[model samples]
Target: MHTRDPHGCCYLLYSAVVPESRPAIPRPMERKILIEAGHRCAIPTCRATPVEIAHIDPWAKVLEHRPENLIALCPTCHTRYDRHEIDRQSMLAYKRQLQQLQNDSGHPTQPLIKSPYMISTLVIVDEHGIQVPNPFKLSEGSHNFECMATYVDGSSASYDPYWTCPLLDRRGKFILWAVLGRQRRSSVAISASMKHERYTELACWVFPPDGSERPPFNPCSAIGFDYSYFDSPTDE
Candidate 1:
């Protein structure tokens, strides 16, 4: 019988076996992936935040955590991909879209104004009271139209109006007032006038109640009208 040292035998067996575990993504790399995806789900339509770091290629096959091979996906999307509801090609496409959006650096794009009850347009106003055209159409009506002001460091005050009045002019102008809200924040008075039976002319004025000096420009002002409302019913 051959006598064997148990410790030496175990060491030799351990050294002969190859490690099969995949490497985990570093914290820094994970953060970079999340940031590149705008902290939102990689799927453009999902927009869910607090995403998970997912591998484009299965770690079982690639065993790498490179940025190009990683993406940020919501738990739902990740599960969908794992379950084969979404194919690998779609996952890679979403990742590419996110990368392309990130490459458009310098001056971030503003969020588009959306409404569920009314069709409307948006105009951006600067600090010098200069109005810039940002025409958009909304299919719904909403009580509030909140957006980032160009002149303000943070998000500007919510553009919620307390009163809405329909003007008697043929131009179809409506006036909105925000006087009953909190103090310090300026009250916005808006007059949205329709023109040429197609477009709208919006005039926004800001009034500060605290006796403070007002900025030379208005940040965001928008005016739009639905042309469908003006369409006459035709006979079949």
Candidate 2:
């Protein structure tokens, strides 16, 4: 039997069925929708991945699983939409933006420069907002080292780096490591632990290859790290 839903989509009602004879449900078409959306939340300014599929029209009203009726949304946005904090019109606009992004082919790219050799000074800040000079120093051929840096509530802004360095002390306690690269900006990932009961911050300053001048540390410029250089098993 077929019944028209409120949004004019027809849904089949199974009046009688054997428990083991039911057809397999179709794969969630929303998975394709999320892929077309670059695996990010459809909402602008929210780059969170692994989003949930939300219906533009409430599923109860539409009873449709079509791509045009579905959108990728982060858990927070999904909850807000379900709770009526975001209205249908706004959701539709975000969906349109995603569609445009998928269709656009003329997006400009950032210019790349030769990788410069960088000099790094590691700074460790304690939970009390005190800046302490890192005792460990970067040596020739020592591209990676581990140390801890703590941050108080107001000490630094939240940022994620491209490469994450996991640090551990002699006793196996979690510590923070700030690794610097030759790029103009650095990337960091912040993880919180209940046992440690403190926030950690990673900061870096990228110097020019010629050592002509020193750049000051700016906490506001840190951003998410891009790891496109790494080769994966999927690569041909």
Candidate 3:
């Protein structure tokens, strides 16, 4: 169950290499990791890049790319992580710090809603085939029945999204939403759709109360959040 590195470090090697082909992290999810670390290594001391996403929990066991379990790290830090030089608790702490940083820096006015714990973006690639890698905050109202989302561009006002169809897990805990929004002063409405040649499936990430994680029900159901323009906006 334990493998020792040459430096006498021990790690759970059995849960290391995934036997089957591992699934890829959604583009949006991966971008979330990079953005958290400012596109550098998540290690506080070594903030170097090009960065790669590291699974806080081993992929071999979890087999899911849940955002809670992913982090951005440079190649060296990644190697150190794989070699057990870095540990899980540290990674988890890093995630907590980064999330707090994002919240403090982006939205100074905190929501008065009970479901304020949620901080995720629901991305659906538009018909035009482009998406924004940046994540805009989605502020929820009571019961999350109706909500407004804000997407910021370098110039102009924030894009407002009137979101609905929040997807819940078996426990009736809402984890994802079907979103609709448009750029400031735009006429057209935009929505996200995933149509495969065979079938389209929907699932939600289940977050445990204990800050633990479960692998996603459908690992391949991952779709990215898009901040890019849906269609060329008409000049106001």
Candidate 4:
């Protein structure tokens, strides 16, 4: 059978029976698929989580773990695809759409890592509950923070005088744990694992810096960035 790689189309070989126990997918490749899906179901409308990496072409047919043939799906969505409720064309479209988004976010495609690094980057798809992840703590100091769900790379988003707290999406997903410094003067240092990496282009709330009363939404606007690249944080 045939499949498409990032460069172009390629071919896959079929096996009569699916391996009862396929080797655990290599961690780096698994991470690639997770990042591509923004760690959620690839279905644009049903982007539920906790996600599972799935084969676009059934493993029973292809009999190999190729990055091009993989996608991320929630339990329900995975079941739907397996049951043929979701078609191959639609699934391929989802992969293409997300890859385009990551490229548009400015990172382009990166090579898999021998080691993973964490940094301060986030994407808030919906505003609701706020939470923080571990390797994080607050001492006594200020921090400069930005709302990067829409305007990653530091927009003129409002951050008030001073605040330090965890932030979660409305879906209760742990998107980020922000201990932001005061607005305008983002000079507060923060503490987080420098190895954590995050990127997403999903549109959320990124208030304008101009102090405008209303900011129209732009669905295509990019989100998240390597905050450490510019706003490297420090401990109090």
TM-score of each: 0.39, 0.35, 0.37, 0.37
1-236: candidate 2 lDDT, tens digit per residue:
89998999999998764344433224667567878677877765454666887788876566556788888888887887888766777677666655655664687432211111111223433334344343322222212222222222112322222232334567877543323333443323243322332223334433332344422221121122222222223445
lDDT of 4 by residue, 1-236 (tens): 77878989687968686457878899999999899878988766566889999999988788889888899989987887888766777677667666766675556654321110111123322122232222223233332233322122122222212222335667876433233322322223343334432322212222332234221221212233334442555677
Worst 10 residues of 4 by lDDT: 112-121
For model 1, residues 1-236, the per-residue Cα lDDT tens digits are 33458565532333355656776789899888988887888665565766888888887677677899999988887887777766777677666656656666674654422211111222334334345334433232322233223211122333332222223345654423222233322233332223332224333323232334232222224455444533546578
Best by TM-score: 1
Once model 2 is optimally superposed onto the true structure by TM-score, how far is the C-alpha of residue 99 displaced, in angstroms? 0.7
Which ranges in model 1 have alpha carbons more than 4 Å from their true place?
1-17, 104-236
Which wins on TM-score, candidate 1 or candidate 3?
1
Considering summed lDDT, which 10 consecutive residues are worst modelled in model 3?
137-146
Give the whole-model CA lDDT for all candidates, comma-separated: 0.50, 0.47, 0.47, 0.51
Query: Cα lDDT for residue 229, model 3?
Result: 37
Query: Sort by TM-score, best first: what order?
Result: 1, 4, 3, 2
Give the root-mean-square deviation of each candidate in angstroms: 17.9, 19.4, 20.5, 20.0
Off by over 4 Å in 2: 1-25, 104-236
